[model samples]
Target: MAPTESNKRLALAIIDFLGSSLKDGTLTADDAESIEIAQSCIADTFKVDPTDEAAVKEAVGGQSLASIYSVYEKLRSKSTPQAGSASTEQSQTDKPKTGAPTAESDKFKSEGNALMSRKDYNGAIAQYTKALEIAPGNPIYLSNRAAAFSASSQHEKAAEDAELAVSVDSKYSKAWSRLGLARFDMGDYHAAKEAYEKGIEAEGNGGSDAMKRGLETSSRKIEEASRGTEPPSEELDSAPGASRGGGGMPDLSALAGMLGGGGGGGGMPDLGSMMSNPMFANMAQNLMGNPDMLNNLMGNPRLRQMAENFGQGGGMPDMSSLMSDPNIADMARNMMGGGAGGAGGAGQGGQGGQGQ
Candidate 1:
């Protein structure tokens, strides 16, 4: 029999998951032979040759892969396909089904991500809700929605989505990172640490390094919390484009919105989108590697008050005014280019840390 619509979808979802995971170093195998079957099957199912990356991308609609096995595994666990009776097929063809969730859900997911990039988090959440209404337990939708919730500072809700993402696919490394981050932000340091540990083991250093750093941050947070002391100010939060993460350091993709930066167009800053720069990543790494470096850099009289302001959650200092002290400005410039702590690669997955 020709491939049915259901079979095509299954093949597509599997390809979306496997192709992306294998390419991104997230699912690296020591030997290529391991995934040869997966590669060949996806290509065969799509009627494309195994060697054509372009063809693979085209078939998957140029969308990034989330979890390959998430939906498929659920189908396996839940119910088996029932062969449609001739009468049922005729009736279905005669009367089109209404409100059946399908590719439209993917479009909703894309819309939600765009809103998230624009920092329209509430709007993003709404879009994600619509997607969920269609493909309820799809891990990709759950994880995307989870990211938006975390961005909006709703760690509890974010944790719920992230939790569901992992439950849908235990091998989903990104979901585990999301879970660790959400738990960290909720002040459940113990749980956060545990989750990160699992995430690190599953995804390895390449894709989920953020979970490892999160493990470290949680350990520190737990120690400090036990003593009834607030965690120290984060070095990463003090630099330009710097944002905060649970008081460890500021990761200001959000603050970047609040800060004054003008792109060619007059739109609200793309805080979330702008954070993809390596500069932000590098600054975070340096500070995390040598915690003392921040103390030394901020020792200058000019930065002391500004650092204090961030620590207190006072509205950010005026950039022009802060830069008026050229010495301070020079110091700030130097700091951004400062030592590498080898602390990069733990992207948004490490952003949650029980805000102080």
Candidate 2:
């Protein structure tokens, strides 16, 4: 599939940022080869040509590196595709045999969905791709693969599959939701919101709670994004329910209490405090539901030590590492996009989180 306009723009933004950094001496001459490699990867990801300098430059036009990277961080998901190819057969657990039967294809599809539920997105995408190989042009397969791609940080590819899915069957509400979600992750909130609206219409506007919740989240994002420019920090304090300066940000002190220290009642967070404290609440919720995410959170050195400290009955230790993680902060911002944030959609937050 050809790259979406959003994907092309992303590739261009990355190239332009690297080019500017090199020119400004912030990125050294020694980094040129690595920069070229990064550019090539972006090109492959978006189906653009690395050799076409003019096209690359035009797409970037004028966008900040910080902004581009923010979108990158935003779109990243739970799994990683190999650097330059999505069709690498070695990653696949079940490769489609030549002329595989329809039943065989369906079997692979079921396995893919199972992996997706388990948060094994890489395995899921591989299985989905294999299913597609057997049953080419299957819209349901396309939409399923798209969801897996989105889960695996393959937003551009996800968008490609989603677009294909919708074109194949206009009534496929799941595909519509997948498309909207992929676009949202790529920072195309307007398009995302529109797609969700379309999806609701496609679902007859009163179908599943999943679709309704999607519309609500997308609408919330549209509202948040319409703020134009931030008024100022002073103005933020006056905004409803926003606690500025004093402690608007998350209080890391709550994590120890939330994360399995007290057996039952004593450590449980009150709804009021939990609602007031987004960062801790988010972590707590994710930890409860996603074992993989819990592993990631605990894998951080500081968090590991925090666990040790908690076991020894220490008070709140330094959570600077968890607090300072750009990925975590971005996830928090995206989730609270409910407040000043709304980067949009549940799937927009961390999994294959970039360290940068």
Off by over 4 Å in 1: 1-101, 205-207, 229-356
TM-score (all chains, Cα) for each model: 0.38, 0.37
Global lDDT of each candidate: 0.62, 0.64
- Model 1, span 294-333: residue lDDT tens: 4444344445566456446665578899777645454445
**Residue 119 CA error for candidate 2 (Å)?**
2.1
Please count the clashing residue pairs in each candidate, in the order shown. 11, 3
The window of 10 residues in a row where model 1 has the poorest summed lDDT is: 347-356
Q: Tens digits of per-residue lDDT for model 2 on 1-356?
A: 88788778777767677777888898999999998888778877887764576676456432255544543443233123456765454546664433343887899999999999999999998898788666665778888989989988999999888876665556788998999899989988787777677677778947677777777787788778777566655534443221222334322333444443434334545555664686756654543433333334433444556666655767555557566856555544544334323332222333334231
